[model samples]
Target chain A: MAEQSITSKPQSLKSSYWKAISAIVWKDLVAELRSRESISAMLVFSLLVILIFNFALELDIGTRRTVTAGVLWSTFAFAGTLGLNRSMAVEKERDCLDGLLLSPVDRSAIYFGKAISNLTFMLIMEVIVLPIYSVLYNINLFNPGLLLVILLGSIGYTAVGTLLASMAVQTRTRDLMLPILLFPVVLPILIAAVKASSGFLSGANINDIFPWLRLLIAYDVIFIALAFMVFDYVVEE
Target chain B: MKTKPRTLIALDILALILLGVSSYLALVFAPTEATMGQVQRIFYFHVATAWVGMLGFIAAGISGIIFLVTRNLKWDRVEVASVEISLVFFFITIVLGSIWARPIWNTWWTWDPRLTTATITELIYIAYFMLRQGIEDPDRRARFGAIYTLIGSVSVPITFMSIRLYRTIHPVVIGTQSAEAQGGFNMTSDMRFAFFFALISFTIIFVDLFWNRIRLGALADKVELLKLKVMQ
Candidate 1:
């Protein structure tokens, strides 16, 4: 029976493949928009982090200049972790992940869909935090280069974050496992992102900032390809 | 049990002899560095341990691939043995490096590339154990362990590259390049021979220990199955 299906209708394969991807993405987005539970939790968690950083780092005028990028990015990174862990845990809890796996969809499609949804939640929280941070610190963080850095950093961050979180959620200490499993591996990305963003914000030359951007891009491409290829192993029952 | 496995007993005696000779060559035979005198001797074992650690890492990664291909538990045992020994040896390497660094670099730690990679690789192995701990089923544990090791092996190099780039932009004081060029004396021919020989000797020791540990794992699995059957 499986062999007969393989022999028949190979052309329909390409279209249904994409159809599966969009369906998964659409499912996550619609569910998120209706419930707003994941985004709201992430958004609130990010604000609390900024608030704590403001007081903890003594985000004074001078300190803010140095720490603004670090504080903001770390906040997003931490809260983005919350969203990723919950995102996977929710699917696993609802048995939706199993259903998705059982469907005719390609496994990579599920990876992309979850990654895209996770990236969206992270970006939304970052977007909200940016304006509040700018208004609070009175530091303009709206620069194009800085925005580019954020996008590249988040892409790389979410690419690996989703993969690791999927593994973590299956573990006994699901929620606690993500950060422990993640921070060490992704240290390079966070370090480069903060440095590059700070450099751009401080009006450093493009030459000074370009290498970091290159690192971020390289990380994003490598891990994205890695996650795509290895998604099969991770999600297989 | 078959009478103590003559080959392993032979390997053990050989390893001990080589290790003793290597230590003597490193400490007494090799001439001391003019700048950093006694601490430099630690480099012989430090580099040797690091080399063995790398060997274990490669073994674990290959075992991971083999496990996935064959879906066999024996390769999983090989993977765990490699990771555990690699973890221990890498810890020794890192500490010995620190001890050597203190008198030589005047700091206990420097984010040198090899040192940083050592730390990251240690973390990777620790995570490997943690992932295995989380699963109850042996098969699933083995699968996840193999997959994580494969992913980690690929990522660790990229991690090293990024850190190296960071180091280039901000070269720490007492890094290997400048320290060797400035303060470190040239290695005598005897020292060079001992150094490479120490690496080869440790490689053999690592293989012997790895075989023993894999046997231990197999015994543990046997006991676990027996316990399960008795409970039933």
Candidate 2:
């Protein structure tokens, strides 16, 4: 903060904030795209989860319709842990995060930047999973309402997941700690997302689905702001 | 060695006595309801423990904010104490609630919002302990603990509400519920005496436990400081 030029114009201040955020986001996105480790693991693990569920549940077509949304979200949620752990692990591995910390930008900028990129990765995985799930279960998963639910749920999930992963990655029990810390905190998003997606698939009235959507939206807004406010403490040396 | 505070000792005794009285009130003073019979006795401790659980959670959350802002080790101690005590009370609350619900709901557990949220909040605090245990440096531990305490506290109410968005069968003790439900009861004046008495007595019990835990945390810090000094 001291390195921030005190006399800098307000317009320039806001731009520089976004500038720092995007730079970090770009750094992560580019690294992940090139290496392809995080998404690939997440994709494979998620498929395995769905595969296990298939054998475990023994769902026929009639049962599959109701269970599909829940299966998809659980897959996404479990897959999410993979991406968060990997992203933070990569930053910690190369000490790039410390370099980011050394910069003059607002720390919260770093938080949002990481969160958005994490959200992007999650959505990309979801996009791939949705169609695969639809084909596998023989149900349409492309409804606009369900997409919105996914977006909102993904935002909330990634927002907290990124923050918790940051803390977890620094701990001695890094791999084991993230999910234990994350799942309880992230439960609300799972509940709301699953419920909203279920409602959409079941062709419930819009009014019936609205409350769950509202819960998801509320979770996203609240947690993103919370993670923004608290990330400074988390990353502080 | 620092001696335990005499006042704490006295309060411990008083707390024991109060617990005995509260149990009597809950067990013998208030007439057992016609529906749930002896099982309804558990409600006294159930609601009381839940009340203290909430008390400790709020204290920990506030201490979390204060520790962050002031960067005071004292508040960090306060935070840990609150969280630990709350964990104990909440565990009791969950168990008692389960016991009470078993005969009525015919299962040890249902996905009722309150029950689910209590479990979630309980896990959050358990994770809080795990986070603190991993860090060796007290300062870093305090910082991480405070940050997590804040996050866990905020998420809990939302978790409660999100689950609560569905239908609830949790006994509406104070509110209007038809007399037909299994555990629902209208408090007669004697029952009211025991109910309010249990709440008041538990507040005292929570304070006493919190004071003892804080003292323990302070002593632990002192021992750590002395060990480092000896090494130097």
Candidate 3:
């Protein structure tokens, strides 16, 4: 009876921790669905970026082969900052963050919750962007490898972006502050993602693409852990 | 106001003298290279300032971690000083590199991995200051600053590695020479002397500047406290 009680206690605690994380994620999703603020802005901004690159790079047939990956990744990165800023800004403006903090779950649960939601928003943006890019540019971006790279890249990007966005919204400059703080630190994700995407698009050797994929995975793991460890300090009163 | 420490004053004088001597060694004493001629002298100061910059980068990363872990404001000050010093020194390194590259690489700039990484690192710290400036509370500023610095330091090396996947034309002086490396040269005895002397002198100068910056930060903190007291 004693052994069963001790074992059951940890299992229940584990389940509750997960429940708290899911609850926070659910809250953000439902709020975003009603408002459609972040996703809509991000989507429109990403399309504009692609349109600008159209004239800016003059994405001709020859150049498009080399630059499609770069153009797509750049759009996503810019749109990403928008979503990250808006998501965290909503929390700060509405005092939702404080309420979340006041709850009895672990601080990292808040970090994971916010990061996952941010990742979800970014992935949605990417999914919409890719199809439009493919149709507009007459290029096929439907490769499984490209999708995998996009997934890994978004995870790393949002992991760091969410953490930085939380800090940025508290600052005086607010939205302006997020990109400055995020871009330089997030360069690894951008570099690796662009390279791997280009390699897949160009039909480069699998072995060549593997290094960047590994880098993306490593970055995602390292930053998620770092964010978890430091989220407590970032949100403390 | 408190007076500057005597040791610091002595160190300042020492740094100035060393800087003067190192300049002489690099310009006059060192032999002009066969390939690059007189422009190669910039390498001495270039490598030295980059070394100092790297030292500060490491120091800032360590102090930032310490600040986050201990929640002590002292380490925050140290981290800021390190970032500021590294930022300036790295700018000097980039400019000097550009000057040398013009005559050697035949272009004012190329998108080499090292050059790109240095510029991005500079941007990261500039963003660090912006982040700190936007915050009103000192504790929160320090916390955010430390966290950003930690993130910047880790990302920079990885950024370097990812870019390095592309071919680099930047000369690797201390490492195995790649055939494609432009403006590569073997150091003569005298050149080596100037190089090592410049490194040592710049390190001393870095220490002096860092100490002074930390002192300035402390005084700024004191003034903030006094102002708060007056307001009360």
Cα lDDT tens digits for candidate 1, B1-232: 3345788889889888888988888889877866678877887898899888888999999999999889999999999999999999999998987897776677788776667778888887888788788888788788878878887787788778776665432122223544232235567788787788888889888988998898889888988988999999
Task: Return whichever of 1 and 3 wins on lDDT.
Answer: 3
- The per-residue C-alpha lDDT of model 2 at residue A23 equals 74
Write the candidate numbers in order of decreasing TM-score.
3, 2, 1
In model 3, what are the clashing residue pairs, if there are any?
Answer: none
- Highest DockQ scorer: 3
Which candidate leads the pack in lDDT?
A: 3
Error of 2 at A18 (Å): 1.2
In the range B1-232, model 2's lDDT, one tens digit per residue, is: 8798899999999899999999999999999888878998898899999999999999999999999999989999999999988999999999998898889878898888888988898899999999888887788889989988988888889899988778777778987863434468788888889999999899999999999999998999999999989999
Query: What fraction of native interface contacts is shared by candidate 3?
Result: 0.93
Interface RMSD of 1: 1.5
How many clashes in candidate 1? Answer: 0
- Which lDDT value does model 1 have at A52? 90
Show the lowest summed lDDT stretch of 10 residues, model 3 chain A.
A1-10
Quote the B-chain TM-score, candidate 1: 0.90
Grade the docking of candidate 3.
high
Cα displacement (Å) at residue B165, model 3: 0.9
Which stretch of 10 consecutive residues in model 1 chain A shows the poorest summed lDDT?
A: A1-10
Q: What's model 2's overall lDDT? A: 0.89
